[model samples]
Target: MSVMLLIEQVLNGLQYGVMLFLMAAGLTLVFGVMGLINLAHGSLYMVGAFACAGVAAATGSFWLGLAASLAAAAAAGALVEVAVIRRLYDRDHLDQVLATFALILVFSEGTRWLFGSFPLYLSVPEVLSGAVTLPGGIEYSLYRLAIIVAGFAVAAGLFWLIGRTRLGVRIRAGESDREMIAALGVDIRKLYTVVFALGAALAGLAGALVGTIQSVQVGMGEPVLILAFVVIVIGGIGSIKGALVGALLVGMTDTLGKVLLPVAFGTVMDASDATAIGSALASMLIYILMAGVLIYRPQGLFGEAH
Candidate 1:
């Protein structure tokens, strides 16, 4: 109810939104460029978290762990692309989904076997572990604010990479017409592998970043993966800008709804009932938002009209 609480919630929403953006960006890119439905993408997220936890524990350096997350995820993605996903490109979405679902099982079980069922924790570095005062005299966690900054930095860098680089041009060309791009002397297969690896790295970065705040455990990526799907669908499947916008929208709506709805309902209902109903609605808000977007703009907010 207080102004400080409101500010803190908004900041929380922004941090969450940015993390979702990181995850959704990769999903959108992979879908746009490769046309593959990878159910195992979330498994890559778990992989990143595990790698970060393991490496950080061994080396006592969060930075090294972060680097390991990126490298391990990228390598895993490339290997998957070459060994399994490449074969699924020409197949139907159903087949792609099934194969990737199998991958999820393999990844989850494999990680459990390697790491055991116990959850791992990643500690925020000492420098980032404290709070900073905001302009309104509100103290906020520095680590969370750092996440927001890092997320935005990555988003901007990704936009530049996709919009200004030669690789971006090739990616666009591949997205538009894979066969034509191949005819034009591009190694389409290699390009797809690179894109998948890049996407996987982004997901890994998100996982590593979040692991500091939450426990790293098996199947940790599934819920976030579903949310990322909602983000891509609401934003438009292949549009990065849409993914960004949709992620922020979903994040704010979900966060604000949870915080504000109960108060609004308390006026009309008992506190307990209001809390229950508000929580339920908050969980459904993003999906409802996605449905509304689909009804109005089938292609998505930033998607090209088809």
Candidate 2:
């Protein structure tokens, strides 16, 4: 492999992994703190994208659109938790699954009704619209570089929130002993709502950022949602650290596989056939990683779930 090409691909993988970490971190938080199986998490992500797109289109300000995404997603999440989600807290996993799955249909149809079936476009800000050369003589999109920086900043903030703050203490206490925390004058219901909303906001931010790179359309969240689940599973569910590590691993594996698999196959077979086969196999690399993880530690790398 050419060294420059390898470097570029590694950077691509890093960017992809950071995006996945955003989605997975939120998901893991909800699972860790609330014990809720929310299949509609993807719906919140789609909500963020639509909110950003609509607001940006109206005001022609990317920053305003970003703010709107966070607000809209947090509001939607809180409302849902207060309504449908509250009822399902005491229900079995199957019932929760059935209810959340229904929500996915509701969100998709509602979004289509409001925004139309066509995809909406979100342009990157002029300040971040161009490419910047790195110290290694590599040029990368400024927006993408911003995303990486933002992801790391969020990760650091999340770590501090979970490990240092009073709210973090309460969250950990709730996760470990919900009943005990409630008995000690803590409002468990309110805490759950806050945690859920926080997670929703993170997912929303991810959607808003990704919208600049891809179409902001209905059902867009579903694919990324699936990958996020895979990330948490391999890294260990309910663990933010696990989510970050798992995301990077999945990102690297998938990225490198797509590039290397075809080349290796081409050494032995026709180039076109090699490319097609390699592409197909590369798509499954993350799942293969998941399978490998599950075989050895079903609870996940950082997961306490048994």
Strongest candidate by lDDT: 1
Tens digit per residue, CA lDDT, model 1, 50-69: 99999999999999999999
What does candidate 2's lDDT look like per residue over 104-124, in tens digits?
999999999999999999999
Q: TM-score winner among the candidates?
A: 1
TM-score of 1: 0.98
Q: Per-candidate RMSD vs. true structure? A: 0.8, 1.0
Deviation in Å, model 1, residue 212 alpha carbon: 1.2
Error of 2 at 30 (Å): 1.2
List the candidate 1 regions with Cα displacement exceeding 4 Å: none
Weakest lDDT window of 10 consecutive positions for candidate 2: 29-38
TM-scores, each model vs. reference = 0.98, 0.98
Assess the local accuracy of residue 220 in candidate 2 as a C-alpha lDDT between 0 and 100.
93
